[model samples]
Target: MESDLLIPLIWTVVFGILLTLGVRKFTKKQPTNKRWVRPKSTDEINKSQDE
Candidate 1:
């Protein structure tokens, strides 16, 4: 009887982990920009502001 209960409990844990990993794998945030660009400087910020 204990072995039967243990088997279901182990399966439940395994299923829960698999579900969490699947959800995370599918629902992950995708990067909008793939390019690695340099950061804007203060001068660039000021120029845009003046424009």
Candidate 2:
């Protein structure tokens, strides 16, 4: 093939592979053993104390 065309073709394929792999990895489900908890904020704590 030609010289200039080869470089851009290689870059496109490499980046395309990376993008697909990243999307697949992100979409894969992960196992969870426990539920998530949210902590109370400082405002809530102050209001509770003042009441």
Give a tens-digit lDDT track for model 1, residues 1-51: 699799999999999999999999999998787798899999999999999
Clashing pairs in 2: none
Clashes of each: 0, 0
Off by over 4 Å in 1: 32-51
Please give the TM-score that candidate 2 achieves against the real structure.
0.55
On lDDT, the leading prediction is 2
- lDDT per residue for candidate 2 within 1-51, as digits (tens), equals 998999999999999999999999999989779977898999999999999
Which 10-residue span in candidate 1 carries the lowest summed lDDT?
30-39
- Can you give the lDDT of residue 47 in candidate 2? 100
Candidate 2 overall lDDT versus native: 0.96
Q: Which window of 10 residues has the lowest lDDT sum in candidate 2?
A: 29-38
